[model samples]
Target: MGKKSGKQNKLIPESHFRLTHPSVSPASPIVDTHTHLASTFELYRHKYPAGDYTTVFDFVRGLYVPAGVQDIVDVWCEAPVRPLWREFADSAVTEEGRRDLWGGMGYWFVMGVHPHQASEYTDAVEADILEAMAHPRCVGWGEMGLDYHYDNSPRPVQQEVFARQLRCAVRLGKPLTIHTREAEEDTERILKAEVPKDHKIHIHCFTDSPAFAQRLLDWFPNLYIGITGVITYSTNTDTSTTVRNMFAVPASSPPPRLRIVLETDAPYMVPAPIYADPAFVAPDAKGKKLPICHSGMVPWTAGFVADLLPRGEGEGEGAEGWDAARVMTVARENARAVYGV
Candidate 1:
């Protein structure tokens, strides 16, 4: 993809993509299948790229929980140069306090190297992610896969890393959370080749052509699309239109409700333009919203999705209105099936 022009860039603010859909009811809960809670502000706050554990915890406590998000499947990277499992174990210890604070329950973490950092992959890193999978809280083997936007790592190298991670997930009986940008063809090819035909996979932060999305869905029954704030904050009507054409109405060409999932790649992709506002003090200590994302954003996302649903079919028979609760429940169940949670 080309670098965004300044004018085009202005149209897409940090939080402009937040889902604004209202909830069907206040009592329902939504599961955010993808997040970067462990990293939070500490991970993104500085150029040095080291996180302050205290700040990370506090952010999760203050913002994420209040959002009404019940559960999260967090994803992040560790120093591949170091012993992988040791770093993961240390992360568990450092984060134990914060994890416990989420209503006194532990949170799930997925360990992997981001495509930008894919060049660091070594035998030890692979071994470590594999070892960490057995930990009760370590649910999957990802934020793996391709990122063509930056190509921070070579294309070949990224492919190698993705294939390796897919093999590990297959061997360990774990699901996958993938990252793809501008590399859709290669990403799909790799998924088809590396992951077993029946493997469960999710393309996180999915922003691609409708045709591509449909092809993947039709070809891989176990694959899913992980939607985030982008679906809501997109000012570009064309993008939304494409989404509607592909997944909104199933009567003409229906997309399976069970193939969709929700996520908040928080601290990075804040849903609303809330981050750009001067008065928009975040719920976290970093002067940002809470780090851990919960289901509070569900209504906003679901509302957008409801708009995409074919209104004619669900009309006056109580089908006209989009039920946020029903959509969220489907999202929750879809995520569980994909992740085997």
Candidate 2:
């Protein structure tokens, strides 16, 4: 199910990129804790391979590494993508697959039935999901909460499946990445009731209010807010509270207090530095101009996030400042902790 193909890409080198500054050597490499790795790679659909690596790994090795990205956690959030995920995971370990799929980058996975497709969730589907979770490559369970904004699936069905999947994650001892939108109250309720204490959870691309962010962070110590390129947008449609949280522990305040991680939600949330307007682009080789989003944009995102963070007073590392390097380091470490990598 993870097979990716499309002639959407650029035959460029790290030197040609303008998204990064050249001074930082081995700058804090990033870990895009959440992304659709395969989907995003194909989304770029490079015109030609950036280097000698095979086509599939081109986006990662060519793009992300150059931009200071180190790892990724690909989330398979729909029912039908499981088989593809299996294929991708299988391909990741082979020598040829290494050249083709990873090009030496490290990645992990999480899979689940999203709330949009809640109607399709069932006992069989649940069993299959759990079985897939057993894969060595699988590290967590989710992108599986409620999305009341669209209500693509009935609220009732969504809740039922949400709770069901929560139980499954808990049963399997895997961390969770819940996707809750416009249903914060219900999400909080379900999380409080269904998820056990100390379970690792991430609210993907959070755009809620600061109060909501504080409430959940206090409730779940291990909970993390999945920040994305959305924060870089001057006018965020969802009004992410992460912008607030980032500045909370005032540089004049104390230690870096929030558990925040960066992600691209690729093929969707493109960082401003890399995102071009509709008229700013042209179609790819296949007569398709794919959206501009990928793990490669993460460095820009990290820089954007660093600019927003409070320059908490102190000398070095822990003394939170607008240090992009520090932020990137924390994010990488947090992802490893979350996925137990």
The residue ranges of model 2 lying beyond 4 angstroms of the native Cα positions read 1-27, 46-54, 94-101, 237-243, 246-254, 275-290, 312-320
lDDT of all predictions:
0.64, 0.72
Compose the digit string of candidate 1's lDDT tens values, residues 25-83.
34556677777654454444432223332454444454455555666777766547234
Question: For candidate 2, what is the TM-score?
Answer: 0.81
- By TM-score, the best candidate is 2
| Regions of candidate 1 where Cα sits further than 4 Å from its true position | 1-27, 43-55, 78-100, 104-106, 235-242, 246-258, 273-298, 312-320
Error of 1 at 285 (Å): 16
Clashing residue pair totals per candidate (backbone < 3 A): 22, 11
TM-score of each: 0.74, 0.81
